[model samples]
Target chain A: MIWNEEYETMPRADLRALQLERLQETVERVYARVPYYRQKMEEAGVTPADIKGLDDLRRLPFTTKEDLRQNYPFGLFTVPLDRVVRVHASSGTTGKPTVVGYTKRDIRTWAELMSRTLAAAGVRRGDVVQNAYGYGLFTGGLGAHYGAENLGATVVPISGGQTKRQIQIMRDFGSTVLLSTPSYALNIADVMADLGVDPQKDLKLRVGVFGAEPWSENMREEIERRLGIKAIDIYGLSEVIGPGVAAECLEAQNGLHIFEDHFIPEIVDPTTLEPVADGEAGELVFTTITKEAFPVIRYRTKDICRLITEPCVCGRSFVRMPKITGRTDDMLIIRGVNVFPSQVEHVLMGIKGVEPHYQIVVDRQGTMDTMEVQVEVSEAVFSDEIKHLERLAQQIQRDIKDLLGVSCTVRLVEPKSIQRSEGKAKRVIDKRQL
Target chain B: MQLEQIAIFLENKAGRLAEITQILAEHGINIRAMSLADTADFGILRLIVNDTDRACQVLRDAGFTVGRTEVVVVAVPDRPGGLASVLNTLTEAELNVEYMYAFSQKSGDTGLLIFRIEDLDRARSVLQAAGHRLLSGEEVSAL
Candidate 1:
């Protein structure tokens, strides 16, 4: 099931040599074509000639989201506007969207990578793919659409929303593969239950390629159990050629294999901006070597994860990265203690009767920080006697403290009280002024 | 005999109780006896209704968390110490009543008490042995 076995199963030594050559060409091309990159390279006292091999990637200046925003639309493109065939942007809530452009060849590369991603997740030619990612501006929708088509699979361009219709289409169309955010996949499963449609018996969804947001393993179990599909994690960003950067192969669910032949990934200590040893958790950085229209030299993804060069059982020689545990931006400093919303989610998922719907509210109380986790309980647990309910709340508090090492108040709300999201579930609400 | 009581979970907010009762009224289901236990955040509305299955269905369809529990309904005299006498007998039999509520017939000199005990069958036999009359679902609905 290794898609494009020529590249996916390339020997490690050969892949490294290919990565080095691409990295050198990308650094030289960006330095010569884009003044912004030239300025950054000069400021770092590093020239294109300095990038001799793949290990020299650390010598290149890191490009961040802020850098992309500063450049805005088309400023970072190596090719002219006429050559850029497609434009997609990430929705930034407060400012202009992080824009990305793809040349005709770049688009083809993206489609090929997505095809590889889908095949890795067990998607085959002629299988029906129901793409539920949001289209327009966001890369997830169209990115997955073209990839499904490129993979020779039937594409149902059913973008996100219309939850009821989404379910109906899945049944009537006999979709075997689903493409969407992990949270939305769970939402679809919930809607299926509401419609009395048995996912296992009534639907044809055998595998799901879910990404665009960080999710825990517990969520994977929940989605798989509810939707009766094998949930596979696919990782990418609009900044780095959209949803086909890396994907978890069906044979080894341990980590996602980065498509190393196209995008070279590195782990770095966020604070020091230095590369971390392989297998150590750190911030993830991607260098799009083959991108032409908009080539990022060394883009800081801000996602925290570890890179695993360990050979996968799936026969693909590509390096694998574990699921993102958290983002540097999502880290909260409460009373000098660092906490991530994913940590709290991990704790809540272990406790019974507590639905995955939860919100972490952090506020300041006279120089001291207070954290409160508001979670929803199932109907059966919510209807229990008062003392039992109180005990459940206390147990959650104890578990969070024991697991996360942070003391937080636990509030058990009634079912459906918490607002559910169609995309990324908002898990944190920090009211601290700082 | 065992009687079925419907329990609905209601958030402790204004008009919640009215909402449930309105749904029941629209369904033509009459509430025979009821008791509400509440905390600061929520409440459980337990009721002895004329139609258990229909009431539960309508309320659940309206998005309410509703469940049913079995209880023993006894006919106690309206005179003083009547409920106390029944409680004393149950105490002698070591049967614990989890919860209880009462209602009276307009013309009768007797009050009906709905008792949710640990064991419905054991409570019925113990109460009947002490000359207490237990009301069945049919008898309670007719009243």
Candidate 2:
């Protein structure tokens, strides 16, 4: 089932050589085209010619989300507008989004990587692939789409949401491969049960590729049990060329195999920014070796996971990274949407008559992530009539939904109820075991 | 006549109602009549107390979100159709009642009804013109 046996099974020495050659080309290209990366490299007193070996990657400056944000839309893209074919973005810390671009060949590379990802997940030609990742400025949707199509699978470009219809289509289309965020998979299973369509009897699903949000082993078990499919964990970020960067081979299903041929993976101590020993948990950093339009060098991903140098049972020589355990920052993925506490505070601050004091309570209810924003009700917001207070709650809910694109319960409590700390107010209470 | 009623926000937790009542009891505040409007998460307790300012202050100090609202009290005959007749007059006069609660007086054969109306002045004129007996703040508190 290996999509490209030659590259996927390339020996460690050959892969390292390929990575070093691509790394030099990427470093030289960025230096000649992108002023930002060149400035960062110059600041570190390192030139493109300095990168002779894979170990010299650390000599080059590390790129971060802040670098992406400062660059904004296409500041870091090495190619001109005519060469770029597609663009995607993810939520940034503030209002503006972090953007990435891809050339035509970059798109083809993405497809090839995703094809490898799907093949690793046991997807092959003739299998009906129901892609439920959201299709928009977010990369998850179209990323999986082109990959499924490239793998020669019958692609049902059905992007996320419409849970009942998703199950209906899966049952009717004889779909074998499911692609979506893990939480949405649970949602579809729940809807299927409600519709009396037992997955084991009414559907033909065999495997699922779930990603875009961190989930637990227990969640994986629950999804597998309910959907009656082998739940494969896929890992990617918009910054790292979307969901095709890594995937869990169905043979091992233990850790996700990083497509090392396209992207170089490194685990570094988040605090010290030093490389952590192999098999040790630390922050994951990536250098897009084969990417053309937007090639990043040593981009700090902030996602905390370890690297498994041991070869996977699937015979792919790529190193595997386990499921991400935690984040270095306070970013809450509610139902697969990135939410920051400051975003909630921004919404609350815009609305008058309510104190800015708030707490975000995130808990999993029956395999779904539920967020409840608890705000302290000031005297000005309190109304003797229930309708007025209800309207206030609705306003907060609407504003948050409009801004964050996630539905959450807004609870108004007595004044001073949300605890205020001495150093920093504990703004989030994440109850999800993951 | 208009009467001052205090509304307290209550979390839907056990002993919350008792705690509010105990706070009022400790303050020696007499409760004339009360009603509770509840939802799944929280409730609003509306009370016509003997002392509106004192009750609101006590609840506010105890960390309860309290608000003062003006409600109209009407005296209705202690008969089944008497309540219906008052509502009929209100319907004819085009007055909207946000909420209402009733309690029978200790001595008289009449019931005291608290009506939360939007336009209190217009409601007062309409009820008085309809020959309905209205109770003042003092009359309701001393009841």
Candidate 3:
């Protein structure tokens, strides 16, 4: 069922050679086209010519999210605007979004990679894919959409949201493959249970491809048991060209196979920025070699995971990254949306009468992640009328949702209730075990 | 006349009401008439205490979100129709009542009903003109 059998089942030596070649080409492309990369490489005292072997990727400077933000919209893009067939933007640490562009060939490569990802997840040509990932500026929906389309499957393009309709369509459309974040999949399953629609009897879904957020093995088991489908974890960030970067094969389902032909994966110590040994957990890094429009060289992804170089039963020569354990930073992914405590602070600081002190409590209710923002009720904000307090809560909730695009419950607590740390203020208290 | 009511914000958890009661008890502040307005996440405990300033000060010092509300206390009959008659007077006068709570005197025949009227002065005058007795802050606190 491997869509790209030649690349997927290539020998280890051949895969390494291919990765080295792509890496060399990608380094040269960025150095020549992007000034940001050129200046960074010059500062690091390394040129494209220095990337002789794949091991020499460490010689080049690591491109961070800060670099992307510095470049803004199109500064890091290798290809011209006309050459780019598509653009996808994700929420940045600040208010701005990190934008990624894809050339026509880049789009084709993405489709191939995604088709390979779907094929690994057990999706065939005739399989009906109900893509529940959000479409728009966010990469999940359209990324899964084109991939499923390229795989010759009947893509429902039913982007995220609408729970009841998703269940109805799952039954009506005879969809065989479901693509969404793991939490959304669980939410759908819960809705199905409420509607009395048993997935085993009613739906024809055989496989699910979930990504965009970190999920646990227990969560995978829960989804599998409830939905009656093999839940496969797909790993990708918008920076590494969205969801097709890596995915778990149906045979192994142990770890996600990094498509090394297009992108070279690296594990590095977050603090020292030194490369970690294989199978040792560290921050996951990627170098988009085949990406013509947005070729990133040694991009530091804050996601923490280990790389398993052992050959999987799936027969893919590429290394598999085990499920992401934690993050290197304080960034949080609530229901697939990337939210930072600073962003919440940014929203809170703008509003009058609210103190800067706030705590974010992330809890998983059933399969859904519920974020409750507890802000201390200062003397200025505290009102005698319950309606005014309710209105204040609603205002905070609305503003946070408007900024982060994630709905959360805003709870106004008493002043000095949010615990203060000894040295630094601990803003986020994530109650979810995963 | 308007009576100053202490409104304290409390998280909806077990022993939260008890904690507030303990705080009032420690301060020797007698709660005259209190009503708890609650939602799923939080609750607002509105209390007419013997010492308004002391109750608010202690609650604030204890890290509780406390506020002062001006509520009108009206003396009504202890019968069932007592509430309806006072409400009807407000309805006839077109005065809006945000919220209302009651406390009956054990010895006296009249019951004191606390009303969070939109226009406190106007509602007090309307109630007084309707042959209703209004309790002063001192009189309400004494109960």
Q: List the global CA lDDT of all models.
A: 0.84, 0.90, 0.89
Every model's TM-score on chain B: 0.97, 0.96, 0.96
Candidate 3 lDDT over residue span A28-53, tens digit each: 88888888899999999999898899
DockQ of 2: 0.48
Regions of model 3 farther than 4 Å from truth:
A191-203, B1-3, B73-89, B104-113, B121-143
lDDT by residue for model 1 (B1-143), tens:
55799887767778989988999999899999899987776677899998999998998788777778888889988989989989998999999888788888777799998888877788888899999988999988887
Ranking by lDDT: 2, 3, 1
Per-residue lDDT over B1-143 for candidate 3, one digit per residue giving the tens place of the 0 to 100 score: 55799888887889989999998999798988889998887778999988999999998888888889888888888988999999999999998888888888867798989889878888888888899988899887776
| Model 3 TM-score (B-chain only) | 0.96
Give the candidates in order of DockQ, highest first.
3, 2, 1
Best prediction by DockQ:
3
- Residue lDDT tens for model 2, B46-113: 99999898998899999888988998999999988878988988999899999999998887699988
Candidate 2 residue spans exceeding 4 A from truth: A38-52, A190-203, A222-228, A419-423, B75-86, B129-143
lDDT of 1 by residue, A1-434 (tens): 77698999999999999999998888889999999999999999999889887888888889987789788878999999999899998643223567999999998999999999999889999799999988887788999998889989999999987989999999999999999887678778877888999998999889999987666788799889999989999988889999999999998788999999999998999999888876899999999989999989789888899988879899999889998876777666454334667778777778775667789998866434689998776666664255666788789899877765558988766567677889888778878543
Candidate 2's docking class is acceptable
